[model samples]
Target: MRWKHIVAASLVLASLSGCSWVNKLVYRIDINQGNYIDQTAVEELKFGMTKEQVKFLLGPPMLVESGYPNTWYFVQYLKPGHDAPEQKELILSFDNSGQLVGMKGDYQPGSGFFEAVR
Candidate 1:
C-alpha cells in the first residue's frame, strides 16, 4: 500500500515538473534590447562628416526625442540577471548645414580615436 502511494506521488510530481512556470523558477531569461554600435565605426567619425555619412557608419538613431532633427541618439540597453542594467547612449550633433559636428557616448574613443591606433 505504501509503494502504491509512492508511485502515485511520483506521477503527480512528474506532471508538475512539466509546468512552464516551474521552468521559469529554475531558469532566468536574458533580456537584450536596442541597437549595437561598433566602436571601430565610431572611430571613423570626422568633425565635418555629413548626416548621411554618420548614418552610413552607425546606422539610424534609436531615438531623436530632443525635438531637434539635427541631433541623433543611438541607444543600447541590456539587463541581465539581478545586477545593474547596462545602458549606452551615443549622441551625434549635426550643424545647421547637416554636417556632423560632435559626438558623446559611453565609449571612451581612446587616445587616438580619430587618429590611427598603433
Candidate 2:
C-alpha cells in the first residue's frame, strides 16, 4: 500500500512539472549579459574619432567579424527575474583610416553625431 502511494505521488509530480504556473513558485535571479554601454557613452562618439577613442568610451565590442575589421558590434541583454528579456545593439563603422564614420542599430546617435570633423 505504501509503494502504491509513492507511485501515485510521483505521477502527480511528473504531471505538474509540465504546468507553466509551477515555475512561479520558484525564485529566479536577474540575468545581465554582454557589453552594456549607456546612451551617454554612445552619444559621446564623434565621427572622426579613432578606434581607440571609441574603445575607451564604450569598452570592447561583442563581436568583430574576421573580414569586417572596420565594423564594431556592441550588444546588451537583460532579463529581470520573471519579466521579459530586453536587448539593445549598436553597430559602428570606420573608414579606411580607422576613423569612426557610421553608427546604426537600436541606439540613436546624438545631435552632432553626423557632423564629421574634416
Candidate 3:
C-alpha cells in the first residue's frame, strides 16, 4: 500500500512538472537586432564618397531619421545577455555638396592603413 502511494505521488509530481507552462522555464533565446557592420567595411569609406557608394559599401542605414536627411545612422543591438548587448553605432554626415565631412561613433574612422595579419 505504501509502495502504491509512493508511485502515485511520483506520477502526480512528474505530470505536474511536464505541464505546458513549465516549458518556458528551461528554454530561452537571445535576440540580435539591427545591422552588424564590420569595422573593415567602414574603413573602406573615404572622406568624400557619394551616397550611392556609401550604400554599396555599408548597405542601407538601419535607421534613417526623416528630419535629419543628411545624417545616416547605423546601429547594432543584442538583447538578453549576461553582459551588456554588443551595441555600437556609426553616424555619417554629409555636406550640402554631398561629400562626407564627418564621422562620429564608437569606432574610430580608418586612417587608411591596413593592419598586418602576420
Query: What are the lDDT scores of the predictions, listed in order?
Result: 0.78, 0.91, 0.78
The model with the greater TM-score, 2 or 3, is 2
- Name the top TM-score candidate: 2
Clashing pairs in 2: none
lDDT of 2 at 9: 99
TM-score between model 3 and native: 0.66
- Which candidate leads in lDDT? 2
lDDT for predicted candidate 3 compared with the true structure: 0.78
| Sequence-dependent TM-score of model 1 | 0.65
Local error of candidate 1 at 5, Å?
Answer: 20
Clashing pairs in 3: none
What TM-score does structure 2 among the candidates reach? 0.78
> Which stretches in model 1 have alpha-carbon errors above 4 Å?
1-25, 110-118
lDDT of 2 by residue, 2-118 (tens): 999999999999897775787887899999999987999888888899999999999999999999999999999999899999999999999999999899999888877877676
Residue 80: error of model 3 in Å?
6.2
Better of 1 and 3 by TM-score: 3
For model 3, the stretches where C-alpha displacement exceeds 4 angstroms are: 1-27, 80-82, 113-118
RMSD (Cα, Å) for all candidates, in order, is 5.7, 4.0, 6.5
Residue 17 error, candidate 1, Å: 22
